[model samples]
Target: MIELVRPHAALVEAWNEAHREWGPGLHEDGFGIGAEDDVDTIEGIQAWIARTQQESGELWWIVEDGEVLGGIALRSADDERVHRFGHIGYGIRPSARGRGVATWALGEVLRHARSSGINPVLAFCAETNAGSIATLEHHGAELEAVEQRGDTRVRRYAISY
Candidate 1:
């Protein structure tokens, strides 16, 4: 079974494996990993894990059995970044795709948002990201528009609790 769990030191190795699967870049969306956050070293990983606890948003790892599959994050709607990035972000490791992991994880986060009183949650994905687009649609997310953000065309969507 897949479960969402808090990031912990105990899962560092598993997290690293997932991280490597993503290759180079800080594009692990749900991890809330900033460019300044170092996750390559023991101390850096520890510090990054600690920082998650301090952020305004909540981050959860997607774990099945003893392996880390990916991560999901629910950001406060009040967050300024929400205007562009939306209320949620997520990613599943390449090895874990096509198994409904994203769909399940997204539902869990939407529930979290609903419980927190965030009535209408906004989300965005690359227009080319069919997987994410389908995941959002699975939750009944309404497409608001498709806008250009920097060099990428992004599809904006909203889900009401």
Candidate 2:
């Protein structure tokens, strides 16, 4: 069974390890892996955790049998960029891919959102990400629009509760 838990010190190592698997994208984005050069250290990870927790949203770790599998985040769409990006985002570790983990994790997040009175959640993914597109469609999300950014395109999906 998979469970969502708040950011904690005990899971810092697991989070860092998962981030390492992603490589060079979000891991360096201050919320991903180690926020600083010493992220491998306890202090660095702890700082990263603090910063994430202090952000304007909720970050949850997807864990099963005490091992971190991935992460999902939900935030209020207060930023103007949310018009392009979505209000919710999720990602699965490479090792956990192709096992319905992303689908399950997304379902859990959507369920929680609906229960919390967050109707019509917004989600976005790169147009080239077939897996993500399929997951969103599997969950009955409607394809609202697609925006072009530089050479890439992003699909916007609206999930209504």
* TM-score list, all predictions: 0.97, 0.85
lDDT of 2 by residue, 55-104 (tens): 76667898887778888877655645346556678888889878888788
Tell me the lDDT of model 2 at 47. Answer: 75
Indicate which candidate wins on lDDT. 1
Give the number of the best model, judged by TM-score: 1
Q: Across residues 86-124, which tens digit of lDDT does each residue of candidate 1 receive?
A: 899999999999999999999999999998988789999
Model 2 CA lDDT for position 23: 73
Model 2 reaches what TM-score against the true structure? 0.85
Clashing residue pairs in candidate 2 (N, C-alpha, C atoms within 3 angstroms)? none
